[model samples]
Target: MSDTLLTDLHVKYIQNLGKNKDDLTYHMTAHLRMNAVYWGLTALCVMKHKDALDAEETIEYVMSCWDDEAGGFGAHPGHDAHILSTLSAVQVLAIHEALARIDVTRVVNFILGLQHPSGVFAGDQFGETDTRFLYCAVSALSLLGAIDRLDRERTVTYLASCRNFDGGFGRVAGAESHAAQVWVCTAALAILDRLDVIDVPTLGWWLAERQLPNGGLNGRPEKLEDVCYSYWVLSSMAILNKLTWIDSAALTRFILSAQDSEDGGISDRPGDMVDVFHTLFGVAGLSLLGYPGLDDLDPVYCMPASLIERMGLKKGWKALPRRL
Candidate 1:
């Protein structure tokens, strides 16, 4: 009930999230099924409880979401292929070392085909463009070892355009800066090995300012703090090597306090209804803060540190010293 992490209860909560297919919420969240699976799986990895979710069943579920016609994965079976869900699918498969089971070439083609002449990427064939989709393309390709197929110069140019005067990146060029956009832009550049395009000091300062007196982070100025930004903001700063700018101890306490101690998950803030997205970010934020007995999270890839290291994708980002 205190600030201590309730790892076991959280694990149970994640494990049960996909069990009730007949539940109304499950069907309602079908659009986010792929992302929700990644969130749950990565949270388990960070908690060192990856076994809580059956690997074979999980892999089968991911495969089921595959869009055969488009050669990309969808949020759920029968859904149209999207860059967002495709990235989540790749992340899930990569974590389990099941990438070999997928047709990487076709998936890579599907991702690349979404790119626009302007260098930004659309979420799907319907053409909703965002810096978020661009990041997804970059990250997914990198995980599949197909980043070499992307036009690196063109991709970095688009991201550079998204940079704002406040040293934060936005959802699109000239848009207002938001923490979530900053994370994707920053992390994408990190994977692309183009951090030189980032104004590190300025963006670091802007990201640090996301922390408020309550020790939680908000997506943008004048917004209320949300637990999910704990990952968005902290991971960006971690990628920029400026994690020390914020008070980790205070933020750690804030995240812990937001956990649903009895029901087992976390919410946007303390006392809110718990869900899988916030739960993953809450735990990941703690890991980046160097919380004791937690696994390291690769801020750039948002996967397990050990896996990123094994893949030789570790960048300059540093997590706080694990207290063991």
Candidate 2:
């Protein structure tokens, strides 16, 4: 996409939110899926206009989504909490340098409450388990700097159960493999410091099969290409240290083709609606392709350069084993 188009889309996304007055608060009318859009949009806006937005104000709005009683975040103040909303809440705060404002211990406890004895994570107290919850749990724990709070061995074993013989991961044990599940599994393994447990070469082969002739990736073999899967499948390969196995040039072209010039965002496919969710992943995909003006994002942990620096984490950020 042209530089001018990218700039325009970014501007449009920010403008769509309109002005925020002192008494203004984000309406909590949507579910967790919609909350992802809010946090994603907030992060995108902050990145685009750091000086224009009051970082403190933006942070407070995002933090309002946290449901302290439920020990997880929700779409709005009174909404039920879930792992997905909790992850987005933390990520948006981290992006805005507001994590220090949160109660780290409480957040960690909330995340720990979602873990099942079998190593899978449920979304909340309701016990809805899925691969997406696993991703949220891993990511949220990593953000809080408290991943060790979970039973790592059990979690790893649970992750292993989700791996299919086809060299991909599934939402649950014995389920069909999917590209999104592969991303979650890959990221979780990276966070747990056990990516080696899976057969990287075989998994990489399965992921490669997702690439379509149009250059974007599909959720499964023989599926049509979509922009979101580009980040899911490509980032999984990056986490596995196997990004080179895919055609970078072709994927880059596909992502660029989905750019909506009139607005400042990307869509799942050409002629689709542009939103913050796909826009962030779309930029992330470009960053993976070594795009200029973007920092090198950690494939395993999706935090930006600033937060990584603040944590004093080593370049690769591997977990150190405890001495016996």
Candidate 3:
């Protein structure tokens, strides 16, 4: 029932994440440990609390997840390398400006090796090819300043294939157009400098249709509205410079209502348990919405705009002006 973001409590909530090893959920989500760190870190940064987590320790944890054998990072220590975790690792380090700690050359090769001839990428040595993994590879490479080494035409060809008649993208060619997949695909296309491949006007209308009567957005048709789409859907619209297409005030209230006012973190919807994933997206979405007191988020990178701009990787996306 809250209309305002509980920023201070959310900060404390993020600060306390992974502190309770006795919790079963900690062990259950080991595969997402690296990404959780990235999520938590990026959330902190957008809230203008980048130093809320100890920098040395944060960067150290990122390094510990590095898989020496694969030259890329893993979800947790001793896990195998994967494109998703690799991108999270790159993002974490790049945000902290500590990319020099890892061997970029090998990491680049590890990522490059995962791409199939068809331009889609596999998640890891195992096989799960999707546009999600494709975006991960492109994003990780762009952050490393090695995207030029990627086969652009071949890569964008796969992206073009993922486009559906509705002007939205899917996890794979012919798959249903999902909001999450749309962000990854749209952001990846922006990183590749390939907006021309997208049918923006049609996609914009389709994305606008995601907003429900309650002001929250759902992934696709008939799905329940969730807080995470605050980032997924809003970010995709922001990248297309269509932020004005959605009702920001109502959507912002929807995001704030999903927050755990007393406990800090946000959930998929109000009355649900909050987690770092939704917490990050909720905060990121607010930033994009120009909520007063929040720092700007670069919708494409999902990081602080300053950090992205400093790396010379800023794109031409637009966010709403901050409230007075």
Tens-digit lDDT string for candidate 2 (1-324): 553227455645655543432323333325643355443544354244434445676577667777767766787666778878888888777666678888888888888888888989998888989978988888788778887787889889999999988889998999999998998888888778787778988998999888888788899977899888877887788777677787877887888888887656788888798766677777767766675545555556565645566765423432111112
Note the residue pairs that clash in candidate 2.
9-263, 9-264, 10-264
Cα RMSD (angstroms) for every candidate in the order listed? 0.8, 5.8, 0.8
| Per-residue accuracy of model 1 over 1-324 as CA lDDT, tens digit each | 458999999999999999898999999999999999999999999999999999999999999999999999999999989999999999999999999999999999999999998899999999999999999999999999988999999999999999998899999998999999999999999998999999989989888899999999989988999999999999998888899999998899899999988879999999899999999999999999999888999999999999989998889898788887
Off by over 4 Å in 1: none
For model 3, what is the C-alpha lDDT against the true structure? 0.92
Error of 2 at 58 (Å): 1.7
Residue-level lDDT of model 3, residues 1-324, one tens digit each, is: 688888899999999997998999999999999999999999998888889999899889889988998888999999988999999999999888999998999999999999999889899888799999999999999999999999999899998988989889999888989999999999999999899999999999999999999999999989899999999999999999999999999999899999988889999998999999999999999999999999999998888898889889999999999997
Q: What's the TM-score of each model vs. the native?
A: 0.99, 0.87, 0.99
Q: Write down the lDDT of every candidate, Cα atoms only.
A: 0.94, 0.73, 0.92
Rank the models by lDDT, top first. Answer: 1, 3, 2
Off by over 4 Å in 2: 1-5, 18-29, 33-53, 313-324
